[model samples]
Target: MRPIGLLTAAALSFLTSVALAAEGKEGMPQLDFKNVLLKSQIVWLVIIFVVLYILLSRWALPKVGAVLEKRAATIAGDLDAARQAKGAADAAVAELTAKTREAHAGAQAEIAGAVDAAKAAAAAQTATLTARLDAQLAEAEGRINAARAAAMGALRQVASDTAGVVVSRLTGVAANAAAVDAAVGSALSARGLG
Candidate 1:
């Protein structure tokens, strides 16, 4: 048999022997221990059991429930705080990214503006330089025209004097030298200088 069964049989045998010894002689009454216990008072047992149930339900059970509720609330509050912190971190990251983008845009705008200003300044400088050069060229041309005109006038005066001398000598004509010189001087003076 199983160990539990063997142990139970031994316990039962010992109880039987004790019960038989506790009895009177064989002719006297054989007292039954089971029947004596059953006939004993039962009112006190019911009262004790009821009192223990009332105390556990009213005080002990409520206290245990309150402790469990407090633990649950603490865990939920911690989870909520974690979630809020995560949201705040995400918002901060987003803000930083936006600021970086804005800074890049601003830098690009500044670079473009500087380039435009440089181009405009270069164009303006070129215009100014070209105007100055054009004015110089025009002034130089005017001076050359004046000098050429003066030179041509002097050449004409010399040619006239030479022709007059040749004709007077060939024809044996006595031309007035003073009149010829005066005419040549007048021709030279008409151009702007004597």
Candidate 2:
């Protein structure tokens, strides 16, 4: 309750001071149209405003405008430079891409050529081996045939001698070589061995 009374007293004092201050002002000087000093003040305000305007237009404004124009031109030049750089980068990328494609194609062609060469070499080796094997086979067959002919000749002579010996032992007579050869020849032909 004491705090509330103190706050009321402070607010009343503030209000009293504001009222006294307000009562001391006869009126707003700027609104006093009949005062003679108001006209002189207006005249001085116009002269200062005109002087400030002239100074700004002739000196400060022109300098500021030149600075803004220079900044704009620099920005435009930087933008054009960036565009040119981008164009150069794009052209370089295109050139590099073309080179990469060409290199790829060249590598493919080389690979194809290598494959063809390998295939041809393999074919040639196979053909050469086949021909060599055939030649060896033919030679072996010829040797076998020669051995068979020699064995056949020796078997015929042995057969004739055995037959003559058998005939002598059984009949006490020597068989004629020509007659035995003819008999063996007839037997061999009948059995399909001749």
Candidate 3:
């Protein structure tokens, strides 16, 4: 009961007790057998308690239980949905990670191929340059050999002319060109110059 209503009832009961005491009563009136309303009050209290019990059991309690059950079902469904979403997210992350690794491997392969190609190209270029240099060296050696041969021929002619001039000037006799040439050839052969 409300506090105000309980307090009012208490006050009324006190006033009744005080009135009874003023009338020379020996004990409380509600407990007294002389009170005529006591039986009726007990009957009404029983009827009201039974009615409240029947209402709570048949209608109000069941509605409250149904509301609680519905709330629990909703919470359980939400939890299941959350778990499914989390699992999907995890799977997507794993797929993404796999794809990333695959792409990285492909890139590495491409880089390795490019490096190999560059090395091959560099080797080919070096071989071509080496071959060209060898050819040029051979040509230079041939030219040097030809020039040396021409220089030897000119030096032999000059030596023979000088010997003939010396013999005619010193001995007063002209030397034969053929003999001078033969002598100079002999001298050069002995010195290992020819």
Q: What is the total number of backbone clashes in candidate 3?
A: 0
RMSD (CA, Å), each prediction: 9.4, 8.0, 6.9
Query: What C-alpha lDDT, on a 0 to 100 scale, does residue 58 get in candidate 2?
Result: 99
Give lDDT tens digits, candidate 2, residues 94-165: 999999999999999999999999999999999999999999999999999889888877877888888889
Tens digits of per-residue lDDT, candidate 1, 1-194, equal 69999999878977777676678422213344355553453566678889989999999999999999999999999999999999999999999999999999999999999999999999999999999999999999999998988887777667667867876998789666777767767866886555
List TM-scores for all candidates, in order. Answer: 0.49, 0.47, 0.50
Quick one: best lDDT, which candidate?
3
Q: Is candidate 1 or candidate 3 better by TM-score?
A: 3
Q: Pick out the ten consecutive residues of candidate 3 with the lowest summed lDDT.
A: 26-35
User: Whole-model lDDT for model 3 versus the true structure?
Assistant: 0.92
Model 2: residues >4 Å from true position, as ranges? 1-97
**Candidate scoring better on lDDT of 1 and 2:** 2
Q: Rate the local accuracy (lDDT) of all candidates.
A: 0.82, 0.90, 0.92
Off by over 4 Å in 3: 1-12, 21-74, 97-101, 108-112, 169-194
Q: Which of 1 and 2 is the better model by TM-score?
A: 1
